[model samples]
Target: AANDLLSKAKLDASPDKVTLVIDPLIDGVTGSQSVATHLEEKRVIELVKSSYPRFQVARFSAESVAKSPIVLIGTFTAINNAGAATGPRDAYRICLALADLKTRTIISKGVARALPDGIDPTPVAFFAESPVFAKDASTDAYIKSCQGTKVGDTIDQAYADRIVVASLINDGIEAYDAGHYRDALDVYQAALKTPGGEQLRVLNGIYLANYKLHHTKAAMDAFGKVIDYGLKSDKLAVKFLFKPGSTQFSTDRSVRAPYDAWLEKISERTAAKQGCLEIVGNTSATGLPAINDRLSGLRADYVKDRLEDNEHSLRGRLIATGKGSREMIVGTGKDDASDALDRRVEFKTAKCAI
Candidate 1:
């Protein structure tokens, strides 16, 4: 694709002059015997001669080879060519070196898809192209640069959507883990407005931050988000946790109003995409044989029932389960209240047709 593009582009914008330089192939191959026996390979020399019948090529001199306007080096190592690595760094270094030797322009196949921001790599009409994804911001930048020249390449929309969703969820999880309830809420608010399965993960983080941390108003608002955004459809979407020996959350409700404001914004995106919510429950080991088991089960069920009450289609689609005293985020046993960190619930989007 690149070679074809370059060939057509160069014809319309011809340079003042173009020269060809060849690198010999590596190893004791067919040309090696001829080069050794005849002091020059007639067959290899003829191949170049026939390929470029119009252009004059310098014969048998390293100095003469270095003096050409354009040098042609093979993509791989060549024994007869006897050049160092033909990678991107090597190509750039070769160009810089040739610049010092009075070469005004360079034409090589070793150019990278993109160079760093400040380094001005001279444009030689050439072709090399690669795909870019949204998660890879660096590659996206490179693709954008290529598009500027080609007017044909465009960023993948689906990849961009996934990247935005994943980033928001990750940020929310980080904030909740750090014990910043309001901050976690803020992260989820930003995330919920985005699209994809990851938005459910962000909602799950918000639910745990509010319900397990004792932010009552925030918890209510988080629940409201589930209802308003129509996200209560995935089976493994929501989760919650609590302090040992008690059902109460671990946080204060000083920041509920701000959380509510954020929830309002997320509700707007739910109608745009037919999304479903899922809930996963977890618990910290802190109690007797039967109590913790039942608590974990009940906590998971509570989230399930809440979704049903919110008027989402519960026709055997919404799912819930208890992971009793397993999957500890923190090492503290069930008896420790400070282990309140371990008690939690997670909510997320499960699947969407779109």
Candidate 2:
């Protein structure tokens, strides 16, 4: 199927450049998992690159997409065979689309099934008669055809290292979500040892895990790394839950008390590093947009004031902005624990004259 799509995309001339964009895969059960998406995307890129060696292929980025044709890969569904009692067994429905940026149209598109680990023929056959798996046979054939080359053999060691790091980070998050702070901390530390592991996600995991374990000094140090890396990657978001529709923080004593300590640590670290900071505020989608916008700004100002009060040097180095409910990490807007992540204060490094 992949080859068919490529053939249909008939190159009048060898593409000078091709960008591969793999959208995050949609898991049938768990919705969207970034780690899984990234891994799958890498796999798709490797496969496409191996198949189309004539074109110069690169990972899609905003800067690269404007000047090249893009091969967009997305997994529509991933279903795990519950009846299979043994090793990993899953099937994925994936879509491949080629878009010509110059022509502004999708040149070729096809859907292919992907079985990462082989599935049990017995269960597959049994389900084959069912409505869901009725089309499985043809899909499986397409999947086999789409296997351009063995991914493990084609991908570079550096890319493999990134996959390892991302996997560990995902494991850490799962552990953290399950309230296993010590385990999560160990996993995050392990990830940090691998190449390409010194990332925002890994550092943030380390900080959260340390904080949960009451390792104040270690958490502080991790937070410093988070700040440094976050500056470069622009991916860090500090949690600051507030009372409903007000600037006052939530009265969760454990979280509230430690937040002050975090501010002090951040202040000292920023001052020592001579870093200018931008305090950006966000809110849950629970209120009027105008009201939320105003309240978010006030919250950012409040954080800036607190930081300035903690470290006088920060007074002239801080700027505050509000995004209201525009950039929610969680968009449920339930006004509960689930929605808490939406209300956050992010610290971004700002450029300033020395």
Candidate 3:
């Protein structure tokens, strides 16, 4: 089973590098919560790294995976209280696929499950096994045969619902990129109706779409939702474009006025929620790493000062940091409007203790 899977994955020649793309695994019951999916991805990556010492590993992004093979890991189903009489318990069925980006075909596929022991039926008692392939069967046939085995006691009804929401989110992003604010808003609204609709990414899209359409109240409301959630991973882009090699905001009044308005709204919202924030500054890949890092740090400090000025109560709740050009969303490095997103500030909510 192992040899066949590797052969199908085209790792027979032992490629020097591979990209790992692990999508967030949705809780089958909640549809929005991740079911230890990130941990699973990390385990797999560690296994690969230890098994293949010569191969370099990189995180998979849409752009980065286009030129290489990708190992895709995700969970399709999860069940809570599987085989349990009364306590809280859960299990997940995960799928792994190796796809050849050049051919756009899934070269190999397998599935595994975390199942509770009938006698124990506790979360800790749940055992997960490595994927296996059927002997003397083709890759497609093995995959089909493995799909028939069922062990979990409860089935996830909302398993496929998240995919619909994901599709809508993608469509909204495409619309926004095409300058169709109204269309993007419509798509975001539709996504909000589905299971897991209140995800941070979805809310961010709604806020951005509303802002673009000049719906100030709606945008602020959406932004408030984001603050209320307070997930540290969520980031809202602040289009505070800076002059090349300068830490100051653009000199144009027209450009500066809108950003000033945005800052005011952000300050009001943060103060109202008593929320702590992380002001992250970024730059386009146009200069030396040391210079970019310094400039980005200064820009973040500038934003922090402005926010505190707008709302003095936020003085101790904000932190300023810089990532330089190392984390550019667009790697073009062009210091222009087209690469403006790469040269902007981001506001990330700080995680609060329960």
What's the CA RMSD for each of the models? 21.4, 15.4, 18.0
- State the lDDT of candidate 3 residue by residue for 27-113, as single tens digits: 222222122544555666676667654435564433444454443433334334355433233554555555444444455655656
> Global lDDT of each model?
0.38, 0.59, 0.56
- State the lDDT of candidate 2 residue by residue for 1-354, as single tens digits: 467566566455755555544423333221233344446555655766888765556534334443544434333444343534331335655555554545444566666676645321111111111101011122222232223222112222232225445456656766776788899899889988877777555776787788778998998788777666555553346667777777877796643546677678778878887889888899977779899899999999999999999999887899999999887644434465423456778877788755
Summing lDDT over every window of 10 consecutive residues in candidate 1, give the lowest-scoring window. Answer: 125-134
How would you encode candidate 1's per-residue C-alpha lDDT over 5-59 as one tens digit per residue?
Answer: 2232222145443444333211111111111212222333465466544334443
Model 2 CA lDDT for position 111? 66
Q: How many clashes in each candidate? A: 36, 0, 0
The C-alpha TM-scores of every prediction are 0.30, 0.55, 0.48
| Model 1, runs deviating above 4 Å | 1-278, 334-341, 348-354
Model 2 RMSD, rounded to 1 decimal: 15.4
Q: How close is candidate 2 to the true structure, as a TM-score?
A: 0.55
